[model samples]
Target: MNHPNMKKDQPVTLQTFKKGDKYHHKIVVEEAGYINDVIFRLGRETPGSYNGQQITVNYEEQGGALVGTVKYPAHNKVIHNTYEMDGQNLAKTSECEGVVHKRWYNKQQN
Candidate 1:
């Protein structure tokens, strides 16, 4: 949780989707390389929505801002993701499970 404006090797993109149990997630951010805006989070369990819900995604870059957390279990359950920018292992899809964390700021020592 250290987004002072977002700027530290900036370049992040994450996407996940499930159709049966219903679950979708997306996050993208890229500067100098184009496409620098996208944040969507949705969870469904039918009837009024937000049933077995858990969604939170936000991206605002120019200095700092990147957060993601989505979970929608069911359909036999078996979706776990953990990508701490190095501890990679994000490839599980039965329902949906995601986690992302990014924060950086260093303009000549602020």
Candidate 2:
């Protein structure tokens, strides 16, 4: 329904959600191609439930302007604190003894 070239910062990966309502967020940008930039490693239940000490991965596709990376759960390891987009989104966040996660990516530049 939405993919008119689908630009506007695209990084998506929020699988299986039903907490309240609004579901579906399984995006792995790159014009549906695939060339690195994909991650989603967090598992206390899911992304935010993984803890939350500031995790901001914005892929604003309502218009355009997105960057990636920002994770910190140091101890086991998951610290790449910040790297705004295409620095590789810091391994796709969520890994301090992760709990099954891996589905995130961003790609859209014109």
Candidate 3:
């Protein structure tokens, strides 16, 4: 559970939406500040999709990684995500059900 590659101050957000027959996942963070406020606000303001599933969201720290968990009880799905940020490089690992997904992203230099 300890992720030494992550940073404590930066929080990560993970989102999954089911469209058609597949679930699309997205993990993102704000470049300037934490994304907690924006994510919560959008979640509340956004209308539910056709799936009509209810989800519970929580946040915690695992080592230096910022962990986010979202539970979809209606579909018996739970996703746990931990993210690491090193300068402009971002990496995330998401576990849902029994599948694990890892990805790396590099921010474009401006």
Name the best candidate (by TM-score): 3
* TM-score result, candidate 3: 0.48
C-alpha displacement of 69 in model 1, angstroms?
Answer: 18
Which candidate do you rate higher for TM-score, 1 or 2? 1
Report the poorest 10 consecutive residues by lDDT, candidate 2. 58-67
Q: Taking the tens digit of each residue's C-alpha lDDT, what string does model 3 give over 1-110?
A: 13354576655655544466433445455543322221322122222222245666655556766667767767888788777776767678899978999976666553
lDDT of 1 by residue, 12-96 (tens): 5545444564434444454433232222423222221122244333212122212233333433333333222222334322224
> What lDDT score is found at residue 100 in candidate 3?
97
Query: For every model in order, what is the number of clashing pairs?
Result: 4, 2, 0
Clashing pairs in 3: none
The CA root-mean-square deviation of candidate 1, after full C-alpha superposition on the true structure, stands at 14.3
Root-mean-square deviation of every model: 14.3, 13.2, 13.3
TM-score of each: 0.21, 0.20, 0.48
lDDT for residue 84 in candidate 1, whole number 0-100: 28
Best-first order by TM-score: 3, 1, 2
Instruction: Kindly report which residue pairs in candidate 2 clash with one another.
Output: 41-94, 68-85
Question: How far off is residue 99 in model 1, in Å?
Answer: 29
| Reference-based lDDT, each prediction | 0.34, 0.35, 0.56
